[model samples]
Target: MLDLNSSDDSSKRNSLKDPISLNVGGEIYTTTLDTLTRCRDSMLGAMFTGQIPTLRDNCGNIFIDRDGKVFRYILNYLRSGFLDLPDCFSELTLLRREADFFQIRPLLEEIRRYETSVPLGLRGGPLGAILIVKVDSKVRVLHFNLRHGPENYELRTCSVRAFTVDLFCTWRAFLALLCERFSYKTTQGLTSPNPCHPRQNRLKLEWVPRPDELPQEQYDKQNYRGLTVSSPEATWSDDIVNMQCSPCEITDMQGFVEELLKISLAEGFKVDLVTPDPTEILTCTSLRLVKS
Candidate 1:
């Protein structure tokens, strides 16, 4: 087990490091992603915790650690290969630390899923084939969208994001989206895209900027009008609003996980849909994986 002493002393826990690597899905995959890093250590000291975040595989299967403290499972074991139990997914705040340590995309994503204020600021930007809502927090690549109301009566697409508000992370760089029909989730995720309109719309990801925090000068206009400009990406529609977001070449995020963990998941992994419960739709990040 990793040499970690849990004392009531908050300072000790704050300065703690792990002696293990965190593995998921019963298989441990530690490639570019690790379980400990400087970034992860800092996130552990936050006062309040964010909402529970979950991830879905390409098979449309949602996977969340019991109690929803998935980050601990990833961060604590990033180094020594020991994932201490009891404080697993139940500890929500620790999860953010783990994601930063391992550089896991999905984990990073879930962290940014809880931020309501456009802290870093976001506006409309090129989201690959469609325009995406961008967030300039920790990882410059954080972004999402929400559209729901009894006004429409179709489906509500609402979500909360949480991420680092101060990390210089990698962006999609040069990526394109490939549009595809989501045969799955027709009955889920913001009311699902109309089957007939398979190509209704999608915002993959392109060169979305994590803009610098706007100063009082920029906000003057909105501020003058008493409008709170939450995010920089929310300013106005430039050429990006005209851009289109397509599907990515990668079919599913599960494929990538399989190769990372080196374990073959069962043919099908599924969960029953819960009604009245707002459907959480995460863009499954399963990409085709290759053995290293």
Candidate 2:
């Protein structure tokens, strides 16, 4: 529990006269007690109760028991109401943990509400072969023509338009792009080849059964399977947008998609699968997402 002493001493609750220096992990930070106690329920507020023993460094600066570098972010949040993280910020999860430790409810809520402005468009990039989707009721379907070629097994190569970079912190990224592109709830979902129409396939994106739900004995003969983007010899790629990701990448991507579905479905909007399973095998004429 937080050690907040609710005594009648108003002077003690007031901000310290001089600038207070905090030595956190060998890094010295300067701030005021007023700023720290703005959120009275926070751990920092409790620490300044005067009842707690203040530990000082060799240089006589008060010491905090946390990472100094990350503490900068927390201090900034205390000074300013908003959390200004850098573009393409990679340490959101770690920062979230720190926010939790500080017991800053507003900061934690800010992280939860944070959305990436980056857009994920299906423009000229390699796509998964199989996709499973759940959709809202709209019979208008967009058609994609997958032609086999020698290089990269390209699917609908001629129609590519780069929209924006892909660095999504959450599934809200996809939701924003989907809402922006399609006004009437018209967006494409999962992709696969239509074996019924070889040489002239009708590439229709539709929902399919989950892996466990599929019949074990007859699953091998089925034409459509879930897409899983993974290979044993896969290497790390810095280019997240163009790079090919395997099933291992699904932890982040899949979690985002699942969250997207939950939010969309709850809001009375249709949801669809824009990608595939991480462990699915790539095949010709597999389903892919595209703008209509």
TM-score of each: 0.18, 0.38
57-135 in candidate 2: lDDT tens per residue?
7676777777777788888999998888765454454566677787887786666556333222221112221223332
Error of 2 at 225 (Å): 35
The per-prediction tally of clashing pairs is: 51, 11
Q: Write the per-residue lDDT of candidate 1 for residues 88-149, one digit (tens) a residue.
A: 12222344344544444444443344323222112111211111222121222222222256
- Candidate 2: list runs displaced more than 4 Å: 1-16, 115-292
Error of 2 at 33 (Å): 1.1
**lDDT score, candidate 1:** 0.27
**Residue-level lDDT for 248 in candidate 1:** 24
